[model samples]
Target chain A: MARASLREDIVNAAVEQFHMFGFTAAGVKDITDAAGAPKGSFYNHFESKEALAVIALERYGATRGLAALGDTSVPPLARLRWHFEALRDENLAYGFSRGCLIGDLATEIADHSEVVRKAVQDSMQQWCDALSGTIAEAQQAGEVTKALEADTIARFVLSAWEGALVSARSDKSAKSFEAFFTVVFGVVLR
Target chain B: MARASLREDIVNAAVEQFHMFGFTAAGVKDITDAAGAPKGSFYNHFESKEALAVIALERYGATRGLAALGDTSVPPLARLRWHFEALRDENLAYGFSRGCLIGDLATEIADHSEVVRKAVQDSMQQWCDALSGTIAEAQQAGEVTKALEADTIARFVLSAWEGALVSARSDKSAKSFEAFFTVVFGVVLR
Candidate 1:
């Protein structure tokens, strides 16, 4: 039980470093230092930095206040909007310094780390799958255009969203994200 | 003349490293070694790795097939589509491996490197400015909806497109980018 909790601490510490410095730039020593754990503990828990990043990506998602997005109880577009708004608020709270971990990894490490790359791909797939379900519902309810498949539209929405986050981070402001939310909710969806 | 050419070679090599390995992961030694220049020459030219990245980004954008996007001689929607299509083709040519350099920096380094971060912000700003011009022209011609400012719509399009590249890199396929092209041209533009 103690070991499991220590493992959680390691993962949690890793998320912050990876969030701040990227997967490759944030060394294992930094992660262990942040966790207050011995260097051996890092090796005992994860095989490589790539392994830790895969886990970090999941841990970041788990705590990002997006559980409600997958509830399926709320309307599709509303849930989608809620997810974006929450991200916007969180990003603003961080002063736009901390963008999405998975996105950061996807951009920087996807070409280099197959393990982390697969994890990012899976996370995105998971998000798209959940989003598509809601978008399908929206389409059936005549809330969205049916010209494209639920999955494809979901992909489109999700992709544009990732781009918006990048824009927000680059500008160090939420206007890019707000622009995304506005265009998505106001024009793209309509 | 020799010095000028040597500087160009350094930027070109650094871009490949940055494009493949990211800004932080691509070491200065690697960049200089790739350039066939003395490792110490790197410091003589740029104050920091962040400084080189700013220039690398500009060179990458210069080589991309987007010069005509700002020409204004072409129709607005046509220029916008051409801009995206050229990117899609470039990504496809790289087998969906080399994504946008500015986006890569925006995702991976925006928080840590202010120099690189501001450079990315400027690049996105320049793209939006050019895109807004074309979009505004399209709106005047009734080619696009006049419901929103060309700048906002341009921001939306640019953000979504950046997200699409992330998606494409995650999946190791161009389908996500192509989907973006389809949605923007078919649905969003209409």
Candidate 2:
């Protein structure tokens, strides 16, 4: 229906603005204006900004997960590498204009917004879980270190990747990503 | 003497507000109110909110560096562990309400504010340099692996710690910090 499409538009706009300006700085008016939707349409779709943020976080997590899972035909380690490369390209395309949306929101609202905080927590856990699966497969394939437990190594890899993203954002350079990926995966492969 | 004290108070207040509400959401009024300084006094001391932020960031970095250095009387590896433990306790005491001020500001303003972005980059590089020195000392003392260069390990440690903070903030738990430190350092020592 047209109404549902409008709602999706509003949520997408909110996610982009919220990622750029953060939850407190990005107002409902700004989201509506960016979406080209009437103000009433925003309220009609979501009860409040907090409610809207919760939905936006979910959408973002789902979309990113699907994109990262692209072409399962590739070997798990190579697929994982592809995912990081895609992320690097996306960050560069944006001119390093934003770090991860989940990261930004987690830092900004984690202490205050319980709903938003849970959404971020869930997204990160899900990411760790997905990476864990790939790592387990790699271990079985003898493509990665078998000495470390799969789950533990997965968590380490995820944490290192997130940290590299933060460094990349701060420096406005993708070199951090390159260095991190090389060192982390290099150790496993060796 | 009074002028120096007032300026320090303003910078401290701005750092607190920025940590709580981020760069864009935090305003001059919020910082001035927190400092108990008059509005005119704020403008007389700083040209703009961005100017105040830069000074506050420098103060924050210096304080954090001193805290991280601690006593330095213990063994090299032990000293490094203690530094992380101190950071863990600080986060727990704050109820994880605050993350690294530099990390928070870098995430929020790096994309949009060139001055703030460069300040964060410079501060992070300084932090990396400091940590690299410690790692080099530890390696020379046979406290860690020499297979990886000290600077590479330094980058890994710093990035992992930052990521652990993000995970801690999201999960509302310090377990991520503990897990990351144990695994990364465990591997290094082995």
Whole-model Cα lDDT of every candidate shown, in order: 0.83, 0.79
Candidate 1 per-residue lDDT over residues A30-119, each given as its tens digit: 989898888778888888888888888888767655567667777777877887788778888988876788778888878777888899
For residues B6-93, write the lDDT of model 1, one tens digit per residue. Answer: 7777889999999988887789999998998888888878888888999998887677555687677878788888888888888888
TM-score winner: 1
TM-scores, each model vs. reference:
0.95, 0.91
Task: Output the lDDT of residue A97, model 1.
Answer: 79
TM-score between model 2 and native: 0.91
The local distance difference test score of model 1 is 0.83
DockQ-based CAPRI category assigned to the predicted complex of candidate 2: medium
Tell me the DockQ of each model, to 2 decimals. Answer: 0.82, 0.62
lDDT of 2 by residue, A31-144 (tens): 999998988777788988989988888887876654455356778788777766777788788877677888888888887889889998998888878877877777787787
- The RMSD (Cα, Å) of candidate 1 is 1.8
Backbone clash count, each prediction separately:
2, 0
Tell me the native contact fraction for each prediction: 0.87, 0.56
